[model samples]
Target chain A: MSIRIDQLPRDKFIMPGTAACPGCPLLIGLRQVMMALNGKMSLVIPAGCSSVIPGMSPATSYGVPTIHVPFASSPAVASGLVSAVRMRGNNGPVVVWAGDGASSDIGFAALSGAAARNEDLIYILADNEAYMNTGIQASGTTPWMAWTTTSPNGKTEERKEMALIMLMHKIPYVATASIAYPLDFIAKVRKASQIRGFKFIHLYAPCPPGLKFDDSYTVKIAQLAVETGIWVLWEYNQGKLTISPPSAMYKDKSKRKPLSEYMKLQGRFSKVGEDAMKIYEAKIDAYWNTILKLSELYK
Target chain B: MQETIQRQARKVLVGDHAVAEAVKLARTQVISAYPITPQTLIVERLAEMVDNKEINAKFIRVESEFAALASVYGASAGGARAFTATSSHGLFYMYEMLWWAAASRLPLVMAVVTRSLGPPWNIHDEHTDIMAIRDSGWIIGMAQNVQEALDMTLAAYKITEDSRVLLPVAVGLDGFILSHTAEVLEVPSQEVVDGWLPPRDPHIPYVIEPGGEPITMGNMVKSDAHHMLLKKMMDEAMDGAKNVIHDVFASYAKLTGRNNGDLIECVNCQNSDYVAVATGAWSGDIMKAVSDLREEGYNVGFLRIRFLRPFPEEAIMDVASRARGIIVFDRDYSTGLGGIIAAEMMGLVPQSVSFKGVIAGLAGVDVTPSEVKAAIKDFIDDAERNGPIRIRKTWLMQKMEGGKP
Candidate 1:
């Protein structure tokens, strides 16, 4: 299923003057998701950059109803909201908009539980690689050798494979998208919305302040992530897998751009040595191999 | 207004079952919970009701107590009457969401089957679990038996949903003792409960609804004064609950012909030299002890403290002022500080009235009626000899190693 740019809704659900930093990809990605949802959804946002983007009391940038839950209970809260809506005889979608720290670390138990139960809700994880809202602490999703406030000397481990983790839950839908590709992101959301059971969409969002990059490079960095094969764009519907466009071009390792093209654009990996990058490359290769194995299951 | 009294049927039920019956009668729309000992029966019963279509509600079997309460918070904010149940460590896991439910001013109900917190892993009747959250801006109440557990669960919705007191309420019942003990409970008819407590008015400004104006809930307050003001509003809501609790109790009595006497239930305090204060199922033993002492020509009375959060200061003072001394029986102890209830009562009761804090029933150790009678007799004998008991606190089951009594 593909979304046509001309068919996209013109109305903006995200109002101006949010707390988002200049050129933050999360803001851009959020706008697309909200637009696709078109004010017909209720959001459960956990503590993260997106949580603060809604602004303070008596002022919210969201044009739809939003409940800000704790850092680890977004999925659980969404579960309750879904049940409540069903009890009211309404089947409108309930969405959990959370960050990497929430989805990968503190909130993993609840998220896994909701997925295992096949809850009828859509969970969108905007992965900025670190805990950006709390001063860029190293999170479970932070890439190998990435610098964060807590991991200032570069982290010692590779990023967690959360999208693959969600796939293992064997839910109805699981997808990965990037902020640079709005059409693809919106298309996946529209697809997931049509499903009945648990659906997860992993979004690669860029943070300017936390990543130590110029605000204008948000889109460039997000795009380079996919071009370099560091962030893959794909969807898992039922058991079938399809890599989205642009990212699908990198199906062959020889066709992908050098990893340095993505790493050099952000200061987070400035101190990273060649050995770490090689290890990261190996990890990415292993990840893609697993995805290939999963893709072959439905054939 | 002329009230029409409708006949309701009574059913034999345990404390856990009674709570489930009350939650059903209140027409809770959403129930989310994780099973813990003692409290598991309540959730199981609720799940059966939801599954059998006897209760038109959503039962969410969440992963943890944190998720359970968070789900309930979400459901409540979505303009639905929500509920959950937990005990001991489960309540501790829900500590964070308890504040969220209260500060968000969502009127949800949670039944706490009181159990001992463990390192030694014991599941028995203890008040420490509920007492831990006494200041979490929630209206707290405890039941003396299965009947009160049922009645209080019904009244909790009315008190919590009242506009003046839009806070969460936890109805506590002692683990095993009351939770598993069977008794006859008057299950109020649906028509009578509906007439007494109407469906929750979904007028909360922040509730998310279709076509409703978009709003951000549980937002950050930058200013210290603003944060303090929100807490102050919670405190004021708790203070305002005194009247709301009484009004609900009166209305429930008019409907069900049962009254818990609003906050505290006192017996034979009119002409007593000393009064025994207790809560939970053990309050029955204290009342029997009071009767035993009365038969022995001792001026003893019993006061069952139902609500612990709004502290029932006035009723406590009224009872304490008339007595020469007050003996507090606490089933839970606050480490380093002694009994929590005794600590709270020390400030409220007149200093002129001698007070003694007896810590007993830790980890479900039974505080038998004879034991209670002996304790009160000792207090009375001491007061008669020394003008008032000199000891501030006593460990009821403590035995001296050297055979010193």
Candidate 2:
């Protein structure tokens, strides 16, 4: 199920040099998305790191047509774009590149509306846990015990189960991907582009600055997250839910890495106490249980 | 589009229905709206038309007023003529996106069923909602009656999509008064509107589409002057829109045999003693009041300020200069300031005119012709006797049990 680096497209849609910081996982994921779609999709982005990552005005890093919309209106905007594009008898896909804060919290209603309408567009939420663009504030999907600016002593609430919520929508596709697994995400994007419905991809992106990790360890942190079984990489296709290739071996609890190792690498979890860790671990276990249960759909 | 209906015909419809009729004629490709009071009927009718295939359009039932406007903004950017409808709270809900559309300079039209903002849940007519967007780089047109509501929808498309003025347009018709009330209006054939408003040129300026040179919008601009220049361009467009509105109105009138005036409709205000100014549903009553006052030997004339943005400043000034008195009837307020319309007129009208900005119909209570006539008579006498008087007062329908304390 894995493709070699040589199989990836040689022509890059995203030019080199952007406002993105070193070891930024968003650029990696965005690059993969553009490559997967062959840079033919119209992109709608709400306010997020991607908005600034496109470089400044007059010069854009993206080599594809893009639109910037209001913070909470990306999904609906994409729905509208698809409508207008198809009206002109063009079959090009309208893709929405949104962030966690936009998709899960502020833009939740619009996200739900687009899904309910089953709009023919792909919506990928690059979830970096918090509102990183706005100075690392707590977002709806900020993990339990994650110490964001607003959640001074670690978040008290459980992180929202957005992927599962999206899966419940029963759209043609719903996926959870990590930036560390570029081939996996690229594969999903290629698969989803062919499905004519609301396709949601919740990407597990690690932030270097926001999470206070070493800039070079961004991909390492994301990999640690998956190995700890905290960020499950899976996809719900048609009526079947299955664990993806990279994460296939890590499904067993015994094979998972130490949760402390993942938490210790990121400073966002610095304030996480023993009690908070217990709560966080419990939540992770519960998430895995549901994901594991759903994996038996086609077994 | 498949011609289901042909030829011009006279039909009596409510303001909401008239807007729906015009939208169908405009051949809007994409429609997105969320239901709100008074505004609901326009979308309801449009949805019915879409469902029945009377009009070929993609109607998206958005979740909120915010999303409703957002969809149209996206659709417009995606090279389609788009439309939406909302009311007071709904407009306010779309406040952020309104700036997005205005700044992006998307050419589109929206019908605002004018309604009072809610504190105690009032669904009646008021001008506060549309008035709040005066500075928001949108051409705001107020329709006095049902006919104007239908005509203005097409006119709005013409003005908004014009190469010179590529901005959003909001055609506001008063709630319950024009919105729910039925009246006779001429519904022109799609061919007529087609002749006036040519198909929207998808590449007038730009569009977000697939397989194009990658261009980013709404990114960081380093220069303050660059940001200010965008605002300046909007102002320049607004200033230039006066002629565009006039030409569009004249062209529309030439074809349809009905003209809802150019920018401001001068009703017998040519060298009259004083002009009574107002807009929306109340302006129709104000016109009646002017006639009533004239029959009563007052010789008062009416000036209905239709396009509130690209605010007919020169037109208002010219009329005010001719007469020594001008009383502005405002159905909307400005919080710490006086009536909204009156406040606008106070700055533009000549120093010679006895300008009185009167705040009336705050909560959409009936502002009848007789009440307006009485107020105008008093205003006329005050202007004649007191000469060049300037003041703002509320024409209260009620007061404390005892009298004005």
Candidate 3:
């Protein structure tokens, strides 16, 4: 179930010289997914950073048919496209590339409905954890104690466990991948494209401007996030959930790099107090434990 | 032509069922719907028809009204003839996507089974709901009865799919008044509908395909010029729809010999002393009142404004200029601006014509032919005594909100 390093597609469908910020993880993830799909998918994008990145009017960066939907309607709109295509006997998958804000906050109802109906779609929720496109506002999936425009003094609420929430709908495939691990994300996208029903990929994308980090540190920050057990890499294929290779070693808490090591790289965690840190760590521990339980229970 | 008549069938149906019948006859490819009161029956009939294999279409049952319209929008963009139905709050909930559909020029057809919006939670009829989206660039029309609802919906598909007017059309039928009221409906053969309304050209705006050449729809441009031109095109289309509506109505009449009306239907406006103007099912009541008044030696006329977006200015001007006065009966009020239909007439009619806006039948209050006759008589008596008034509006409610106006 692994793709060799040399076997990756040469053509990254997302052309360079677009509007993406320096070290934009969404762009990276978009390129990987497009490469995996090989530009053979109709894209349904909602309001997010990718909306602008895919190119504005007369020119497009991606060499595929893309339809920009409203902020809250990517899944439902894709459901329509899929249905129409299926009616025409064209069983090609329609992919929805959306941000955490659209999928987790404003568009949760549509997202849930699409999952429940098992609409044939590959919905990639590119999670930057905040409304980065709208200038770093807090969203439902914005992490606990993360500094965002709306959650100015550290968020009052914990971020939602969206991957687990999507899994609860019993979709055919649910996976979590980070931009730091392109091979894993590419493999997940490739696997998902073969599935018949609703398949969701929670892509962990980092934001340099939003997270108060340097442009050069984007990949390193994402790498630290995975190493520190902040973002777990796993895949729930059909009903069997298994932790992916990139995150398997971190299952043992002691092997994980120090949480402080990961936090110091970003300014979002700068003002995080000891009490907030303890709560944040506890939430991460609880989340991983729950994932472990779910993987076993489904197995 | 003879073969087309052989496919015609007659059925006793409510407005909702009639809409379903029209959609089937038009051979709609994809239908997405969410159930709302007053509009629920339309989808229910459509669902059964789809399941029973009576109609070959994809019936998508969506979670909300927003998704209902959004799905159809996507389907239309994907080169399929699509439809959706909703009412009142449902229409309001789906309101944002309606602009998307209209602006994209998707040629979608939506039936608004019109109902009064809530709190104190009412479920009956009102034009205030449908009139809310007048400026939304959609081709808007109101059906006077069940038969008109069927014919109008079929014509809506033809009108919207026309190359000159590649925009969506919303045909509104009053809540229980039309949606639930059963009447004899003459359904033209599928062959006739197919001959009249061809399948939508997928390349109008271009359809989305997997392996097809790359096309990005609705992308943000640096300049507002293209966006401005799109809105300008909508205006041109609205103007251009007048000819399409007439042409469609003419061809449809020739095929079925049932020429209901086009844009605005008038009754005896030729040198009439006064012309009563209105829309919706109450137009029938107004017409009866005009006929009664004409028999009583008063040269009065009735004019029903069919299509709202195009406004039917020329026809309205013809009737308005000939009459000594025009009494606009509106079932909808624009709140701070008096009646909606009244406001349109007030803006359009000749400056010399005496005008009065009689706002009535809001929130499902019944306005019979006698009440309409009485209102017309009151307006004539006042106009006969006084000279031509510039603009006047009167509230015709039993219990005026904070007392009489």
- TM-score between model 1 and native: 0.96
lDDT of each: 0.87, 0.88, 0.88
- Candidate 2 off by > 4 Å: A273-279, B1-7, B400-405
Whole-model lDDT for model 2 versus the true structure? 0.88
Q: Candidate 1 — which residues are off by over 4 angstroms?
A: B1-6, B388-391, B398-405
lDDT for each residue of candidate 3 in B301-383, tens digit (9 for 90 to 100): 88888888888888888787777999999898887889888887786777778899988898899988998999898888888
lDDT of 3 by residue, A113-143 (tens): 9899899899999999899988999999888
lDDT rank order:
3, 2, 1
DockQ of each: 0.63, 0.77, 0.75
lDDT of 2 at A121: 90
Q: Tell me the lDDT of model 2 at B267.
A: 89
**Docking class for candidate 3:** medium
Model 1 per-residue lDDT tens digits across residues B1-405: 123333777689999999999999999999999999999889999999999999999888888999999999888877788999999999999998888778889888999999998889998888999999998988999999999999999999999888899989999999999899899877778988888888987665357643355777866655668889999998999989999999999988877778868889879875687999999899988899899989989988988889998989998888888889889999888889888888888777676777889999898987789999999998888877776554557889957599966
Question: Which 10 successive residues of model 3 chain B have the least lDDT summed?
Answer: B1-10
